[model samples]
Target chain A: MLAGGHGNSNPNTNYLKSRGLWVAYSIGMLVLHLILLSIPPLSIPMAWTLTNQVHNAITFIVLHILKGVPWIPTDQGATSLLTHWEQIDEGRQFTKTRKFLTASPVLLFFLTCFYTVYEPHHFVANFLSVCLVTLPKLPLFHKVRLFGINKY
Target chain B: MDILEPMYTLVFTELVPSFHVHLQVLLGLLVLWVLFKKSEKPGRPGKAGKSELDIINDWKPEPLVTPVPAKHRGLNAPVTKNQIAQHITVNGVKCLNFATNNYLALVNQQEIDDVAVAAIRKYGVGSCGPRGFFGTVDVHLELEEKLAQFMRTEAAVVYSYGFSTIASAIPAYAKRGDICFVDEAVNFSIQQGLVASRSHIKYFKHNDMMHLEQLLSEQAVLDRKNPKKAAKTRKFLIVEGLYNKTGEMCPLPEIVDLKNRHKVRLFIDESISFGTLGDTGRGITEYYNIPIEEIDLVMSSMEGSLGSIGGFCVGTTFVVEHQVLSGLGYCFSASLPPLLTVGATAALNLMDGNPDLVKELNEKCDQLHRLLHKSETLARYFRISGCRLSPVKHLFPLELKSGTENELQKIVDLCLQDGVALAVPAFQLNDVKFQTPSIRLTVNSKLEAQDMSKCLSTLEKTVIATFKPTSTS
Candidate 1:
């Protein structure tokens, strides 16, 4: 009777609940995704199908929860799952960094507005600020910094 | 000035609430700025604390751990020539000719070298500046034309790398208010392109058409709802001809059909498949028999297959010319080195000359796959796909079989010690994880059967030793 009580009253119940919430949220995302498909004037979907999206959503949800558990590290089931997660994250970061660099022009437009408001009369300050924010995004700027600005 | 009177009134009289509020906000921001200054790092105020050379001399190269004979011995020990490979000697080792990206063995070939040399002599070195800034040379045009012909497209523009190819091209062609539907398994480059653009991007799961369809449907609804607000001209479906990590063929024919029926534009990245697929190594467009016209944009890196140093995108003349002039990569960086361009052009030419290269590559893939499957120790956990070496290579997942990254690393170490180079990938989708852990073995046409057999034997020994329970180090 005592053993059963301890098992039932374990604090991991909250952890499991949180895990369950994540899972449910993932499922809901899949449903939302499905609903998104039905509402559209969508003409052509790419290589990915609705079923694949759901499968990936399920995969991501399960992997995220498992990654948080300490015991997960040693377990075979959780280990490979975690590896896949690392790969995906690495890919995402790589892609994101490049996009951020290219999108600097768009970001500069916002910075320009901010500059106009912050330093209204100082022409040199606004020009320098715009240059500072936009320079690093250009491939030429990156190369110059990497190789030396005076190298050419 | 008239502006001074208004400013004076705001500071002195406080006549307008709007002016008074703006002044107060400005004062608050100045106070916050002063506060932030106090939190910065405190460095020596006057002179350097010590000589830079003195600090440098004191620094020591500390080893992570004392060398372990079973695992790390090879890394530290002086390697002899025979240990690495035949006909290739690097760093005093005749390293096994396994680590090269010379898929068709065309990079160093005499024919390729001659063409490259000829182009260099004719064009001179360097495009001098960005494509937008007098960098476009006759050689560059010739290369682009050749690429268009090879890919069977109307026009093509080259970039520095596969990452730049996608990042630069997609954003140039598509814009904000436009919708781009991407494959979950798409490369980092494609993702970069999407993020750079102002378009609303929807991600579908790996190889999931239904999800993509749904996304399109949703976008259509959104467009209809706000038809007058944001002017969106068209939707694009983007994917790779071959996924980089997973050696699986994309459902190209199906995707093409979808594009035709749905009136959506299709973009394909054929970096992996360019020289390793189809009869003439023309890539997925050829393999699937999809018309070149159906593919609005084609992007690929010449690094992996052609063994060169850049990437390219083929499309309509308008799009290609525009991308050349306005794409961020084209407008920013120096054009490809004349030598690299010539080498790539020569590689493409070689493929045209030797139709059997693809056939030979397919056989190497098959043999390697068969040998791994037949291995007693490796067969249990490792799965090898067929000999075709599809768009991404064969999807032999290491993490899936080893159960953990640590175990996967150990297995990888064993193979490395035995002199086999493998590609270990950390790949993700929609912020989730996945690893197509199998080594990316890029087989060259010139490699002998013995070379492959030796590599396989080393892999077998490594696997057996790693899995053997009783074998003490």
Candidate 2:
């Protein structure tokens, strides 16, 4: 509703497209990093360095485009919503175990990368094994299960 | 095998092929461009020639309007100093002082002066910062502890100014969404406190218990409609021990009963009543025999009875602690001067040593009240109001006239001319409620039987001359 577009256009569509772009970019970068790790000639440390630089560059470009395009959701609306959510959440208490559970997926992904660098392995097999274990725990998939498509 | 060997080898040798790294960087840049173009797919087809900067530069905001100052009636003469007991010099004329609040006549005590002089020689003058900073000194803490012990509260906190004590203490507990039920005829300081709290304020008629109950009942109905909000909203009842404007004692016993029945916190401001009421001058709570713990907060100004500057709030340890961090005046304003604090300490000690001074002051209040009541001329024109034991008394005109205030001001000036001083109530132009225009007389222990008689006779002659009946058929 705040994007300054035609009245007939669905505001939800803009929200969903903006959210979907983030999800797609995160997934694409993860797969590209794994592919780079599979090249036998590239050392593990060099591959990791390249992955981090690429990730920063892609994030900068995506955020710049999202801010300039009028049809995409503005940063102001997201910030307001996040602030409202935080105010509501401040009154409720959450357990330590629940917090740890929410953060486990990111932790697991970093552990798998460390293990692969520490011990030489078949790169493709190790990458596939890590993906199978980490994909379900990704926050994007959990959000989909909890809120469904319309909420995005 | 060594850590230094690995660091040297890494710095000397190229870790990855330069061509491959450049290719990856270019690929990331190309991917970003593609994503940006895709995002633009949903935007409008055409582009404007001017950039967004041009549009922003052309924008203008609305202008602000300046406020006009309110017109005021200027005073005929300004008071100069406390020349002697029960007298002050106004416009270079010595008049019997009935305007000051020095109820115990301790303003110019020799002991207090000696203590103040000694403190100045030791601690110098100002504290130069807020309480939490480097402002607090040994005397400030001693005074706070003494006040707490004097009031029989668990702890107490002192502020730099009298007006800001209540103003800061109210908002320290009550916040934006809270509800405060206030007396309609409270002083300007209490009104300022209510404004700063930003709470939902409902005013009851002055000292009207039935009207206050009606408002409480109405609030109950509204709370029933929104139980969630009701659960979160805190309710408070604020009143003064002896109202500064009317000089009447608040019905504290009835107020405490209502507070219990309605489950509301009670806050009492005893700025005028402290050191001027009760047998030993413990204030309204002692007068009514109410326990100190029953009231949530008790605030008073040292300017009135202590014969010094600053104010204080005495309460339980928990309630008093919150003010250190939350009270705006205490946290931000410069601390009270060490000399004044020591002077107040000496005054409190004198009060503790000589409880007879309070008794003498109480007798003076009664004597003055009796004298004013028995005056035939005053009785014919005005209604004498306020408790018999209150040092402050108010005289309201029985009939209203178009030039009633002008007539009252003329009477006050005549009293000054006759070597007696009387005060006319001054109200802010934009105040929400207007009090009746009246003359206020402050009684002090220093006035003798003859002085009281002389003051009454002066007022009588002035009133008779000003309001003589017109010749009738």
Q: What tens digits encode model 1's per-residue C-alpha lDDT throughout B1-473?
A: 97456456544664434543454355345333433433222234453576668768878989988666674424543334532222444444344555546667666677767777787787776667777677777667788899998777788888866678778888876765567888877777787778777677778877788787777777668767866432435588898877765566778887887788767889888877788877788888887787778888888888877877889988889768777545778767988878778788777777777889888876776666666567766666566643356523442643454444445556655655555654345454443323345555556667678887887777667667665662443
Q: Per-prediction DockQ, in order?
A: 0.01, 0.04
Candidate 2 at residue B108, lDDT? 88
Taking candidate 2, what TM-score does its chain B reach relative to the real chain B?
0.84
Measured by TM-score, the strongest candidate is: 2
How does residue B176 of candidate 2 score in lDDT?
A: 62
Shift of residue B465 alpha carbon in model 2, Å: 1.4
Highest DockQ: give the candidate number: 2
TM-score of candidate 1 chain B vs. the reference: 0.74
Stretches off by above 4 angstroms in model 1 are A1-152, B1-92, B117-125, B221-233, B373-376, B385-387, B391-403, B426-438, B470-473
Provide a comma-separated list of chain B TM-scores, one per candidate: 0.74, 0.84
Model 2 chain B lDDT-worst window of ten: B36-45
Interface RMSD of each: 22.1, 17.2
Residue-level lDDT tens digits of model 1 in A15-101: 323436545744665575467557556321311133333433344344322322332111112222222222222222223323332
The TM-score between candidate 1 and the true structure equals 0.58
